[model samples]
Target: MDVLIVGAGPTGLTLGIDLARRGVEALVVERAGELFPGSRGKGIQPRTQEVFDDLGVLDAVLAASGPYPHRMIWKEGERLGEEPLFEAAAPDEGAPYTEPRMIPQWRTQEILYARLVELGGRVAFGRGVTGLTQDADGVCVEFADGTTVRARYVVAADGGRSVVRRALGVGMTGEAVDPAPFVVADVRVRGLDRNHWHAFPQDDGSALALCPLAGTDEFQLAARLPQGAAPDLSLDGVRKLVAAYSHLGAEDVTQMRWASDFRPRAALADRFRAGRVFLAGDAAHVHSPAGGQGLNTSVQDAYNLGWKLGAVLRDGARQTLLGTYEEERRANAGAMLELSTGVHRGAVRRGGATVQLGLGYRESSLSVETRTAPDGLRAGDRAPDGTVAGVRLFDAFRGPHWTLLGAATAPAAGIRALPSAPGSYGPGVFLVRPDGYVGWAGETADGLGAYLARVGL
Candidate 1:
């Protein structure tokens, strides 16, 4: 195989889909027997929605998700007030997805996995990677069953307690954003209206929140535990916690589907790559659940890496293209870590920054800006969605190819060019990369050939 991805979570599955569509020989291996069955990582930011759009899973995701509802505060069974959980923004020409959508993490993974299968990708479940050895040619991965597979490159998306990261001797350094442990569970509960997220704060410092999950009859229950208190994962324990924290009786919670306990922490790996192996998602960076940055950041990590890997393994690109995956994504992951920690500590709001629309790779080595007097969008910025020459910009840029916008002359073979729309893109020829970022910009296509050659376009 050209590439081996460990952990079939959103990160690995997303990479699988991207590589499959690019015709790269790749395989995804999961340690668990099946997909995760929890409501963890429930918020999908706008930037991630765009990524899903490119990966061809946006419709399914949108169908399964719903807009975030206002949080309804409750005091002793009496309604206090309601407030929006996220700052609202209207859609504009630059950004069509102005707000985040709420969907269970499991549903998101299912959609990605289905898309991967549709693209002729394969995933081996219950096959956990035990260790790996790398050479100049490829990486040799050993599984728990004593079987081994060799691939040109390996990606570690096995999550925070990643065995692949440990085998590579990578260390994660971070601090606990919140010292108190919390329990999150998916349960079917009665006596609660499904229109809003119900939040109940106890006299003690702990709080409980029950949010109605969209497109399902379940509710995600989250509660902060008392100091040094052990979390109960059983149905009885969930009922007790609900009764202790909220006005509803223990019997109100009818069914408990899944539950887990965790402490909110922020951590990033020392490095994202070691030889032929690369770290992604929770393996590279772990974020607090606050601000809904963890899963979104993880998905984007796979998106950043998938195309580079495909270019090197299938499109004859130089190995240097793979190096930028670490350089660009490590910095973005670090920024998201800080944002998640800040939101956890009440130092930041869950608004624009949390949406992740402003993230870009302007400082990356791959970004080439030739215009001396740049005005509007520059190289390395996200190519905004709009209509140019009667064709939607995103529609023209879709698929595994490069797009040149506003070019006076026709671009080289294999590059699609759209007539200049100075009002939207300013007076420059923009080379939009496969991942939807402007990789090169110039007054004309003078430096276009060289830039495309660098990336094997």
Candidate 2:
């Protein structure tokens, strides 16, 4: 295999789909027997929705998800007023999706896994990694069941306690984002209507929230436990928790599908790559779940690495292209870590920056701008949605290929060209990377070939 992705979470599965569509030989291995059965990472930010759009899972996600509802505060069994649960900028056509969608993390994975299979990808479940070794040529991965797989590159998406990251001797440095223990569960309840995210704030500085899960009869129960108290993850224990936090009786909680407990913390790996191996998702960074940044950031990590891996393996690009993955993602992950920690501590709001649309690789080594004083978006900015010559920008840039908007009129070699530039992009030929960021820009096609050659076009 060209690549071995350990951990079949959103990150690994997404990388699998991207690599599969690019015709790269990659395999995803998961230690878990089945997909995760929790609704922990439920909020899908707008930028991630754009990623899902290109990956062809946006429609499924939208169908299964609903808009975030207002939070209904409760005190002494009496309903207080309502407040916004999630912060979002005012709606605009800056992109197809401006607001985040509410879908269970499990459903998102299922949709991604389905798309991966549709693209002829394969995932091996119950293949736990016991150990591994790497060389200049490739990486040798050992599994718990006395089996080994070798690939040119390996991605560690197995999550925060990643065995692959440990084997590579990578250290994660972090501090607790919140001192209180937290418990999240998915349960079926009878007393709560599926309209508002019901919240019961306690005077003791702890809180409980039960939000109706989109496209399902379940509710996601998240509670901020008192400091230093251990959480009980049992179904009965969850029922008792509901009774203690709300007006609903313990018997009102009918069924518990899944549950987990954790202490919120923010951590980042010392590095994203070591030799032929790379760390992605929680393996590379772990953060507070306050602003729903953890899973979204993880998915973007895979998106950033997917096309680069394709360029190297399928298109014969230089190995140096792979090095940029660590350079770009490590910095972005660090920034997101700070943002998540801020949100956890009430230092930041859940809107604006939390959406992640403003993020780009402005300082990346690959983002070269030959044009002087280019108007509108600069090199390495996200190519926003627009239309030119009756052609939608996103539609033109959809597939596993680079798109050139502006100056160059004709498609050349492997690059897709749209000569008529949208007025918003200023006046230059912008080469959009497969991951949707403008990699190179120029007043004309000058130096375009040089940039392409550098990226192994």
Candidate 3:
């Protein structure tokens, strides 16, 4: 096989879909028997929404999810007031979606799996890896089921506690964002209205909330417990938890769907790439669930690597193109980790940085700026959406191909070339990478061919 992905979560599946559509033979394997059933990692940032749009799952995501609801604060049984759950962002011509959308992790995986399968991608479940070794040619992964799979490259998307990461002796350094234990669960409760999240803040520094899950009848119940406390995920324990926090009685709690306990922590892998195996998503970095950066950052990690991998394996690009994956994503992941820790500590507000639309790779080696006096857009910035020469930039950039926002005056590369660029993109010749970042910019298409050669076209 060309590639072997070591998990079937959003990161692995998104990479699977991208590689599949690019005609790269890749396999996504999962140790679990089924998709994750929890409503964890629910917030879909605006940047990730754009990724889903390009991946053809945005419409279904919009169909299955809704905007975050206002929070309804309560004390003793009385309603205090209502406030926005996150900082508000307005839609602009460049960005159509600004606010975060709510969708359970389970639903997101289901949608991604469907898209991967539609692209003829295959995922083998119940395949747990025992260890893996890489040679110059490929990586041979040994599974606990007494089987081995070899691929040109292997990706560790198994999770933060990645078996692949550990097997390779890669060290992860992190700190506990909060010393207190936290419980996150999805349950069916009768007393809470589904319109607003009900928050009950106690004086002892402990807190509890029941936020209704959008497009579903269940509400996600979250609470902070004392240090070293074992989280009780049982139906009876949840019933007691809600009753103790708010005015609701234990009888109001009906069913317990899915539950997990976590100590909010921030960790980063020592390195993202070790030989032929690359670490992505939770395997590379772990973030506090605040500001919803963990999942969004992870998904983008896959998006960034998927294209580079496709270029090397399918488009005959140099293998050196793969090195930029770690160069770009590791720094971005480190920044997001700090943002998440700040949000977890209430030092930062949600909405702007949390939306993840402003992130880019301006400092990457792949970015080239030939213009001495660049205007609004530059190399390594995210290509904004707008109409250029009667062409929609996002629509033109919605596939596994590069885009050229300049005059197609002569025999140019096979990239999709627009006659002109939108005002938002400035009046510069631009070469948009397959992952939607401006790779090269100049006053004219002077060094476009040289840059394309590095992209392995």
Candidate 4:
């Protein structure tokens, strides 16, 4: 295998699909016999959707989830409140997705897994990594079945307690926001309003956030139990929590589909790579699931690293390209950690979606330095989406890429023109990456030269 991915979760599967699409041979090893079927994270950001578009999996995901409306958040179990978290007004009309869709984590895994298989990569389930040894040449991975495989690179997309990360002796240090454990239940609650999220504030210093599952009247509710509260994983517990929180005297809420317990912890590995072993997804960072950004961030990490690795392996680019994976993604993960932490804290203080997704990495090597004001947004930063761009294409749906909008013809190279007005967005700028990421931005004539000179492009 050219690359061995330790886990087949969203990040690993996504990376596998991306690598396969780019003609890179990769293998995904998962411990479970099949994908976990449940809702973990609900909201997929516009930026991440752009990556899916680039990988040609967006349509599949959309097909799997048909006609799901944007999630609506509520306070105290009521609907008609202030604007929802994703429905708030932004400067750009098309900046965010026309509608932010919701899908369970397991379904997301299935979609990615199917795509990976289609791309000539397959997942070896019931195989878990137990040992790993890496050197300058390659890495030797040992599965629990006493099987060994050699690969040039290894990515640990496993969850927080990653065996590959532990074998590499990478120390993950961070604080646990909630010392006590909380219960996460994904059940189909009947008699609940089809619209609006329901929250019940407990007197014992705990609360719940209910999110609706599209097309189904049932809702997915996340509630924090009292510290050290160990409720049995039964229908009784689900019914008890719903009634206790909502305090609805007369509603028959049954059908407990799935239930699990999760401890909220915040941690980030000191480094993302060691020799041939690379850490990604939860293996690299874990934080509270406040903004539903964990899986998306991990997938984005894979997205960022996949292309760079392909460039290095196929194009013989500098090995230093791999170094930027940690530099760029580590910083992005740190920002996500901070944002999630704030949102978690705000949940305890004031109940609402306080976390905003506006992280920008303008200071990265991948971004070209321009004359934009320091405080203003930059090319590498998360590009703002709006209607001013004249087309929904630049509206932040496809993630920020090299967008050159203007009338004047500037010499540009290594750029992909978008399906929008030529040079209307920026005359000289010719192209933007799928992520709305500007690979090289400037006049087509002199812009490519100036960009190539800056980053040796």
lDDT of 2 by residue, 126-176 (tens): 999988999999999999999999999999999999999999999999998
lDDT of each: 0.92, 0.91, 0.91, 0.69
lDDT of 3: 0.91
Query: How many Å off is the CA of 276 in candidate 1?
Result: 0.8
lDDT tens per residue, model 3, 339-388: 99999999999978889888999999999999999988889998899997
In angstroms, what RMSD does candidate 1 have relative to the true structure?
A: 1.1
Instruction: Evaluate model 1: give its TM-score.
Output: 0.98
In model 2, the clashing pairs are: none
Off by over 4 Å in 1: 408-410
The C-alpha stretches of model 3 lying farther than 4 A from their native spots are 409-413
What lDDT score goes with residue 105 in model 4?
77
Q: After superposition, how far is residue 353 of candidate 4 from its true place, in Å?
A: 10
